[model samples]
Target: MIFNRVSYGFAAAAAGAFLFFAPAAQAMTKIERVVSPGGIEAWLVREPSVPLIAMEFSFKGGANQDPVGKPGVAYMAAASLDEGAGDLDAKAFQARAERNAVELSFRASRDEVRGSLKVLSDRKAEGFDLLRLALTKPRFDQEPVERIRAQMLTALKRETTSPNEIGSRLWWRTAFPNHPYSLPTNGTLESVPTIVRDDLTGFVSRTLARDNLKVGVVGDIDAKTLGTVLDQVFGALPAKSDLRAVPQARPEAVGKRLEVQLDVPQTVVAFGGSGIPRKDPDFIPAFIVNHILGGGSFSSRLYNEVREKRGLAYSVYSYLLPLDAAALFMGGTQTRADKANEAVGLIEEEIKRLAENGPTEDELEKSKSYLKGSYALNFDTSTKIAGQLVQLQVDDLGIDYWERRNGLIEAVTLDDVKRVARRLLNGGVLFTVVGRTQTAASAKQGG
Candidate 1:
């Protein structure tokens, strides 16, 4: 009986046929506001589910706000919070959280830092107090800080020699030169050593302003009570300067090729061109195109060509990283050293073919259908919905974005998709190879 929920696949199949046939349904869900006495603002959705409460605290200026030479300050600070807080030691705090069945975590992305908390209804006060301590009174204990820093440093040192990491970092640096977005979210070795306690403190103080905080609470909680809880957690944060201003991203050099030789059996190749920014009028169409290209998993062009037909790589995929200023379209595959070049060639050929002759009607319909039909599955939980809402807010999407999102996907026409593919995929494509060099003898021997 539970298997009946698996209707998304069929719904997706019907998406293409009904694109223009059905009228848009009423989509807006009225967001309940939670306004605290301290002037904190939050969107509260009260669902009396299983006696639990989940809240998301989102602050602007995530990894992008990391100071130059300190690339991972945001991540480092986020990681340090759980290590120690208030008077409790790191292990003690963790044990306490587990004992109380509370889930509190911090994560940092390019443009936002999120602190999430989930707890039982009865222990909401205590759970929230612990979260507040982590947010506003983290100790940055020397012992735990050093241990975590050493762990991260060791990882960075190891990743430097990894072919996958080498190719990925190279792509970002080449694709986004002179932009904060170009910096690695994980701090480099040189930068990690310089991150003192004061650096973490200063970053938290400046970036965690009340004005910059957006709270979303869901589950068994009233708007009034949730507003009070928000104040308890975020009211102590000092009012500081707006840290939301992101630096303008420089234009990416498309169609560029880069190669790195590492002693390995397989070569890793990453290639693609620029893509539409989040605010582009063609964003929906471009999204559809991306899904058709590789974002649709087994049903995509790259997978069909590279994996199924030529067997060039075990897996190949493409995706669109649509940001505020610009978008980066990237894809990659790993193959045997000798076959690496051939695989890259095939990928390039496919890119050119898509440019020269746009997607077929069938392909376009399948892509649009998949894009619209599968979106509902992404919001199965309140936590996920809150996260999506935060991103929509950061992108300046309207309040009714979630309601109208499916309609926009349906509006993307075949021509619209073709136009975006031509316009956005013009950057100098980078060809990065990370593997052992094939000797002349090996080349001649076809080994």
Candidate 2:
């Protein structure tokens, strides 16, 4: 999933969890790239100030590795990872973790299967043991599998009536057509049920291997100790993952407006189009531009134009969504059913306006300042810091990326913003709305 959220809460297609955490305060954080004797590497931040340690790691392939008919195999596998392991049953395993104060979970996102662990420094041995077993010796017992699948089935059922889910998934299906990108990260209603134990085990063996792993740890653990922990927990996995090649894709059906008419009171709107990938030279500038356009909260052009001035919707937002396979410029809003067309029209107008003229000098400077100033807040906690390091590794940003991040923001020149604005927004966005709207007959958007 893209760290920048897709509005309607479904942009990453919501297979599972993706948590965004910023690096710790620049002065306090020193990231250590620790490599184990067994050749495992982890980014570590030793914060003895807290007795708790937090670690996060991920394997490269997520739902992208699911078999053709089973979209949620990765998701179900991840959710079931800790259900039992080695000699432990589900109840015993969970109880042991609780007694030792270990917090652990696994989740599948669009691009990776992720795991997080937190434990008291005194309980490190027990926590690491549990994690190791979960990774290399997961049981995937039948009872637990049925339980987790049932839970997921219930959630999918709820999404049937959720306008947000309907609109978000519809937009994705429209955007990518036949590619894997079009499928929900969590499989469709029909595919999940057929995922048996063999499928879950296949996903693990094919994707969760040492070569594709990235790890980050924060709090209490020193580099030498962490090196040992890394080897112990990860050393036993297969040396290489058998990840299949997934093609790079671009959003299709640009400038088109599609709808699903449900009898909801307010309309759910999701819109997006082509975007710059994370590694693109212009991405940082695009990020700042997006902030000024819609991410600046109450002061953004989108919020000010659509909500504060015209009162068409209660909230409106846009973000840059750079995924492993594709990138997107996305946004969402909800408004009274009667006002859906006007709200969408106003959104398009603002997009066109921004792409045509670019942001004002004031908007540019303030957004830069806000973005730089608020960054360290994301890493205030040990869990957040740990998660962030893992994410940075996934993005392949340098070990020193955090130190240089604010400077990059400062360097986004007016010309840079203007160029990226036209480059990104001029193409227009695809709109997928759910609800009965007053202007159902309105011409298709992105035309």
Candidate 3:
């Protein structure tokens, strides 16, 4: 009998062991590139010990492809895929999935439409067939489309009063004013209702094509079997996507601050600035620098300064957020309305300090150790491995990135970290504050 679900109850224990005792033993699991008879290619990691399979695939052109007037069409279309497919109605399709003990879902992000499938090895055929149907023959039935659309609209309505959500949305809007990246993934209220079945169908047709697809699979699957499944699942897609080219953009509104006045007791602050891209040669050094500055949990400078030292906020940290079109270094904190300016001031001061002097040699060594030692936690399960593989492909990192990642971090010298720190943190930060703030008047006055 096939296991209905893969359990990771002991994953925490195993991860702990790996982190403490086997840190240096971190090694890349073998990855093989498989090409189908029809020429569909996929990255596969065969793990015969497990009886299940996990596959992740993505197609370029996500919400970024949504037409001028239709911002949420891609997101809605992804949600609609598993609702019904081919000859199966909504209920029947979901019933089939349950009977087969398969998990299938789709998501739309700023740069890609991604899908995930997990099933027992014995039921591979059924799992692949369901995925194929969702990709190539999604029914986009009226009922499912309306149901998902309504749910999204309700969420958007709730976002109006959500300080965190409001702050994040405002940050993006201010950062990428005229760009598609500024558009909400779930879309605005006006755009969700405008989405129709035709729009969903068109999105699938134009975006889900072979040329733009990247796939990664893990667990009890071999190269030969995966090659066959790849073609059976994706061979029917168009040779090329009809996606519009998205131009490169940088985060705007730097050195400016915007405040949305709310009656809430606590104010939420969201801030962002320029960042190094994933493909930049200095990315490894930049990653280390960020860890010492804010990416590290309790050990980071921001956390020590903002929360532990002054007790001005409950939490504060910053990290790199590299997107396909732009890169950003962003951070957030929540504090009492009265202390909002103090929190923002401390954040700015820390950023300036890092840019000016960079991390000390001790700070640099500690960050590299933590980063390298904690890397083993990412591969404690087949699903995690599969997810990492997919992300590596999306970032255009070479197939051997898993093996080389640790070395890259270890090789960053003190000079490299200081250089990247100055490069990334020298830029002005744009701040967006939501909720009651004593600084609101001054912020707006300056803007």
Clashes of each: 10, 2, 0
Overall lDDT per candidate, in order of appearance = 0.73, 0.84, 0.83
What would the TM-scores of all predictions be? 0.87, 0.93, 0.93
Better of 1 and 3 by lDDT: 3
TM-score of candidate 2 versus the correct structure, residues matched by position? 0.93
Supply the TM-score for candidate 1: 0.87
Tens digits of per-residue lDDT, candidate 3, 128-229, equal 998899888999888988888888878888888888888888888889988998888878988898887888889999999999999988877889888889
Of the two candidates 1 and 2, the one with more favorable TM-score, higher being better, is 2
Clashing pairs in 3: none
lDDT of 2: 0.84
Question: Which portions of model 2 show Cα errors greater than 4 Å?
Answer: 1-28, 439-447
- Order of all candidates by lDDT, from best down to worst? 2, 3, 1
Instruction: Using lDDT, give the best candidate's number.
Output: 2
Expressed as tens digits, the lDDT of each residue in 1-447 for candidate 1 is 000111232224334331222112221155576789989887765666346666777888788888767887888888888776898988887777766667777877787777877666777887788888888889889988887788778888888788888877777777778777777787788888888898888778878888778777666788888878878988898876457467566446566566777777788888756777888788788777777777888998888988999888888888887665556787888998888777877878877777767778899888878777777665556666556656666677766777778888878787887777776554446666667645321111000
Residue-level error in angstroms, candidate 1, position 228: 1.2
lDDT of 2 by residue, 110-188 (tens): 7899998877788889989999999999999999999888877887888888888888888887898878778788777
